[model samples]
Target: MTDTSCIEIPEESSSEKVQQIDLLYKCISKLKEADRVLITLVLDEKPYEQIAEITGITENNLRVKIHRIKKELTEIFHKYARL
Candidate 1:
């Protein structure tokens, strides 16, 4: 899986943060409901084990799903950022 841990979102003021969140929700809205939930939990920084338990999947499988989800989100985010 690709390493995404090094990526950092810069901290911004409250107004900027709201705009960023709006963009995020717009991006996530394109995903399936399950994938939207997965991305939301991930952005919340929930641990892998907890996410696995909540999703009723094994940690390994959860990791794979998260990896794919992150990659998709990254693409969407970048696409939007360019606009």
Candidate 2:
């Protein structure tokens, strides 16, 4: 979603990694439960079809939703990055 293939998880200092993890949790916590679950499954590398079946959504619709969710995550992550 949102071409996340371009995003590289940088090797960071331990403290920086912890801060990034904290920021990620904060961002994810703001999502609705369904969105949270979807994102989590995506993060876990679950297949789209499987995720769709579990969430009772069509694959196309789930793709769109995941794109939007990733966009939101990018925005939230940037907010924390700025700080």
TM-score of each: 0.74, 0.79
Error of 2 at 74 (Å): 1.0
Clashes in each model (backbone N, CA, C under 3 Å)? 0, 0
Could you give candidate 1's per-residue lDDT for residues 17-74 as a string of tens digits?
A: 8988899899999888999998889989999899999999999999899899989988
Report the lDDT tens digits of candidate 2 across residue range 1-83. 48988899978899988988988999999888988999999999999999999999999999999999999989988887898
Error of 2 at 8 (Å): 18
Highest lDDT model number: 2
What is each predicted model's overall lDDT from 0 to 1? 0.91, 0.93
Off by over 4 Å in 1: 1-13
How big is the positional error of residue 58 in model 2, measured in Å on the Cα after superposition? Answer: 0.8
The parts of candidate 2 lying over 4 Å away from their true place are 1-11
lDDT of 1: 0.91
Location of the lowest summed lDDT over 10 successive residues in candidate 2: 1-10
